[model samples]
Target chain A: MSEKLYSISVEVNGVARSAHVPARLSLVDWLRDDLRLTGTHVGCEHGICGACSIMLDGEPVRSCLMYAVQADGHRVTTVEGLANPDGSMSVLQDSFCKCHAMQCGYCTPGMLIAAKGLLEANRHPSDTEIRAAIGGNLCRCTGYQQIVDAIHDAARRMASGAK
Target chain B: MKSAPFEYLRADSIASACEALRREGDSAKIIAGGQSLVPIMAMRLVRPSLLVDINEIAALKFIAVERDAVRIGACTRQALVERDDALASRVPLLRQALAWVGHVQTRNRGTLGGSIVHADPCAELPLAAQVLGAKMVLRSSSGARTLAAEEFFTGPMVTATDSSECLEEVHWPVWSEPRTGCAFTEIANRHGDFAMVSAACQLALDGEGRCVRAAFGLGGVGQTPLAFPRLAARLLGTKLDEAVVKSVAQDAAAQTEPGSDLFATADYRRHLAGVLAARVIRAAQEKAGGGK
Candidate 1:
């Protein structure tokens, strides 16, 4: 049986996008499949893993926990949005690459988004704060040490006016 | 896994949400924040024919610090609850308990009303509500009614709310005492995971370092969050020394009907309940006395 489809208009990655999605279509699914923003990975389809994390109005939230219809009028920032206008890597993204934060690269997108969300809110987060900020995003590899180092490094880079 | 297909309606107001609930009848479920409900839905545990979306109800997303209570609208996000300095200053335990909730991503979407209404046996919000004697305002198509946290939370994930009633807001009473302190602690396998057992308490001490008012409770050890009013009353007029606190905590823990799970045995949970309850009561006492 087919359910009714609802049309949603969302500003994703600074671009206006529209789609007809079923009520059960998660925001992550639409971003990954419909819009081809495959940077956001789906780890745990449930809310536990932050693999499908996206910035909903500048705050990182689990896209898997939200339906596309729920994003009808909101602005979303996927990992793809964490880039300079010239397609260069953002400060946090570059820090992740420099620090070898992800071993397998599966959780990179979500981790970048989470770290971006944190650095946006707190320009200079302490070690404990960085650990807690990325606590939700599970990275089996890198022992989370590199992720912490990457966030701290990004904070330092930004502090030195190296954005 | 994906959720079963269901009709969705974004409610703009409480009356309309109730109107939709009454129209949809028993097959309708309210979706707030969609943190827990979405996961439960994705697992197919529940497949409501009509899912009423109350996240857009602006009236149901507010925090009003009243004379002696903080009236929090049901849709106020947990992230907001965690960040609100004013709410934290008044009802400090609310903020303390929020740190033990789900991760940052979930908290960004989870709502205070949704958490309490979801009413998990081990959830932090309901335990805080119970410990604070929070009041729930339920609204229906016909009218509105209020219920205390004791009456509101009937069982694990079960509430006194009927099919057509939606929780409008929660009234968390703010302790007016000057020398007040609260502590919320839980034992989870991982940081941000569900608790094996949790304990929280709010204490007020007079000038003589004597307990004037006390309320404490244990979660994840019973069908519902268990609050010990009578045992807490036993704390009044005492200095809440280790002996008295431990004795009261042991009694409170012994009364819990904890269930054994993979993470912890029932016996272990009961023991932790006793230990944590005593620990928090003492910790709150110390804080009230400006110990830390």
Candidate 2:
């Protein structure tokens, strides 16, 4: 017989989404495959890469490490949710573009989520704090200097009342 | 890579979790934070027939500070433990070691009991737990029992906790001494990577800067984290001079049986064990001695 399925209802990007998933269905797969929110990339299906990071109840965590059933009653925010209400890029994303933070862009979504998570709690993070925040995320390109610069610039912009 | 399919059971109560574990026996696995478990599962290194999720069990998630000990429930997130100032005041080594844990994202979900039970020999929390001589409470449908950290950790990725048992909580002894100081440090390729060698030291000093009570340990150089109570006793009545600290750290490192891997040779890990153990011990001593 096939594996049993469990139903879960998660609030994704502020919208309540429900699905029937197998016990082994990872949260990242549910977001990308079933929900069609492909912004969250999958890299190194294990927890190391952090490419599948998402905010669970406002705290960033590795979605690949969690099964979809584990997120049944939780609120999840993917990279797609980081955009402005008018669908424009958020300041952090804008800063990333302004700094050319991404090369091939594979690691950008997770990077944005990690940086956003850091900024929400720490309004003005130091360079060391920014590096530590994105330490789990691995980008073979950009050497991480640009990503750190973008996050540093975003913090400055946000502090100066830039929407 | 993907995990092998399994039956998912979310236990609402600790007792129910124990019952489920007892029923499934060897074929079942308890998933708390899934930080360590999921990675292995995705690699297909572990494929349990039943996956018991204890994350939602409210009884398994708590941090209670008692008169001489701090009891942390099994599912308490590492981030919560890292951020809790009061708990840190009671059990200072916990936060010191947690700083070197995976990262914000993983720490946000990883649980203390999970890390200790998963029991990677080089894990930061397990090394801290070893140095602090923490007590782990294991529960099954039959009953609950406690084991000391040294006894609980048998080998790499192994614990005294059996398949039928659920780790309910961990009790960390809180040193009430006024001059108690603790420190934890590790050498890893990356900030979040597993350490090549890790050291933890917690020492209490009297007003005269003489060691009264001390505990120190090293990880990544042994089957399980190794604590040196007898060697630490040699520091009693001393001011923790460089000679004694170096001697104790070297002696402790000599007893370890580190394995050679791609990252570090056994000899190099042994060498680092001595260096790091001495570093942390001095740091802890300086803190207790008020930097004198």
Candidate 3:
């Protein structure tokens, strides 16, 4: 049976968006299907994969595990929110490209968001901490070493004030 | 994989949440972190007609050190527990157990209270709480009450929590002893996957470096996280000699009636539990400085 619908108002990437969603509608679905912000990927319907990762109230969470209503009045940042207002890549995004960390690029958005969460908390995480931070997000390609390097490089660049 | 139709109500306070639960009775389910509830809903394992989301209740999200105990609000996220300094120094077993609950993202959204209430036999935090002598606070519309860890879990996914009751907080008694150490160890196929067998142990040593008290709890081995006081008694007031530790580990293995699953057979689990228990208990004893 089609679930009953609920109205939700959320701030996505600094934009206020409103939508009518089914009670079963995941926040990821509302962002992709309704708002047309398709940057968030859906790798696993369950919480195992981080393709649907997003920053909820400044902490990265699996959007697939959260209902759309849970995002009401909360700040959500997807990969699309990574660019500057003038559309320049975030230091993290540029680092990923410079390091050629993306092979399939399917897991880039989640990897970037996960890295963003980590780099915000720790400007200089050890190799083990960097690996542990992104352990939740699976990357089938790039051997993951490049992603680790990208995060480290970005952290160093950010700390060095290299714009 | 969609959840069935249900009315959503965000509770603003504990009284309101309990009132909502009382109003909806068994027809409604409480959602804290939604990590456990959302997946179970998508899988159609449970279909409640109403969902009382308690995310807005600020009172149920705290980690405080009371005079006699450390009080953790039930809605406190598992990630918070993993990073909490007070918990690390005060309740290492609980802190270590928090790391194995799920992945970083799941832990970011999952709550310690939710894990306990979910009552999964393999959940690490519950077993850790059991071994540490933690108490659970259960609130009803009319009033509130508390239960020891053993009294909290009556069966698999079954708690003494009634439809009208909501879990408010968990209290862990603080240890003032200088020579006490705890260890949390689990065996899982993947880092974030459910455990095949998990165990937590806490050891306290007297001034003479003899074991004064020992508490061991095992998960994924029974209908609940089983506590082994009989085994702990064997080592109390005695030095943790290899033979004594081995005997206690053997007793722990024998005590577990671990069921066979797709991951591990009951026999294999018994063996793993013995090895891990022996290893962790020795480590904990050493950390407690139990040897002269």
Candidate 4:
């Protein structure tokens, strides 16, 4: 027997969006395939990989591990929403570019979102805190040292009153 | 990794959820954080025809400190529980256990009630709940009843909760006895992997610093989290000296029936449990005395 699909209305990336998704439709699928928010990549599909990481109500979560219907009425932020309203890159985004934090860039979106969450939580996270914050996220291409350096640079720029 | 399709039901009330579960019968499953269930569903391990999303129930997200107990609603997120000021002040062991549960990302979405209902034998919350003698509140269309930690878990990934019932809340007793302390220790391959062997120990000291009440719980050592009642009795009324603590830890480890897994053999786990028991007990004792 198949389950019924439900129409759920959720605010995605500051825009109120609605979708009719099957109960089995993962939140990552809804964002990447249905809403065309490909910035949120799906990796492993299981909770092991943080490639589908997104901010759910200002908290980082693996979108693949949640149903689209479950995110109804919740605020979701994807990598595309990292830019300002004027489409300018955030400090973290610019830092990634400046620090050459992208090798293959497969895990870049998830890394950016994860770092975005960390910066919002603690604008001045220590090296250890930075490591702990992004521990769930994995980058097979660029060694994590670059990601850590990018986040630290971003934090420094943000603290120095730089946009 | 598409999950098997199921009829999605957004329940606003506990009564409605129970009724939906009853109507759907064994073909229904309730989802809180969907951290564990969604993955299992994607794996097709469970293909319930009805998917009950209980996130809309606002009543199931509170943590209240009661007179004799702390009442935690089922939908309480692990991060919220870990960061809760009251829980940290009263039950620091809970925070310690929370750090061992999973990484921050997983903890952000994993719910306490969902973790307990999933009942993974190696799960940190259930093991901690068992050691703390927590009580689960199960509600259904018929009525509600409370079950202790040991009774709540029947076997691996199984609980006493019936098909028609949903876990409402868990109540953990608050210890007001002075000079008492608790500690939890777990060793895993990574930050979030299943623990090889974990121990939770509570020590209560008397006026002369003698052990008054001692409780020990061992995890990942059997089909269910176990308590070392006999070894606890041996520690009670003792001076908590190094020799006595070592003896009690060895006895506690001997009582375990650890299962052999790829990460550790049963004998190795038993040995680790003994070492951990001794370490955690000593730490709890030192903390009780406000020392190193």
Grade the docking of candidate 2. high
Candidate 4 clashing pairs, residues 3+ apart or interchain: A3-B6, A3-B7
lDDT of 1 by residue, B93-185 (tens): 999999999888889999999999999989999999999999999999999999999998899899999999999999999898899999999
- For model 1, the chain A TM-score is 0.98
Candidate 1 clash pair list: none
Stretches of candidate 3 off by over 4 Å are A1-4
The TM-score obtained for chain B of candidate 2 when compared with the true chain B: 0.99
All candidates in order of DockQ, best leading: 2, 1, 4, 3
How accurate locally is residue B127 in candidate 1, as Cα lDDT from 0 to 100?
A: 97
Please estimate how well model 3 matches the true structure, expressed as its whole-model Cα lDDT: 0.88
Provide the overall lDDT of each model, using Cα atoms, as 2-decimal numbers. Answer: 0.93, 0.93, 0.88, 0.87
TM-score of chain B of 3: 0.97
Chain B TM-score, all predictions listed: 0.98, 0.99, 0.97, 0.96
Report, in order, each candidate's fnat: 0.77, 0.94, 0.64, 0.72
How far is B77's C-alpha from truth in model 4 (Å)? 0.9
Native-vs-model 4 lDDT? Answer: 0.87
Compute the DockQ of candidate 3.
0.69
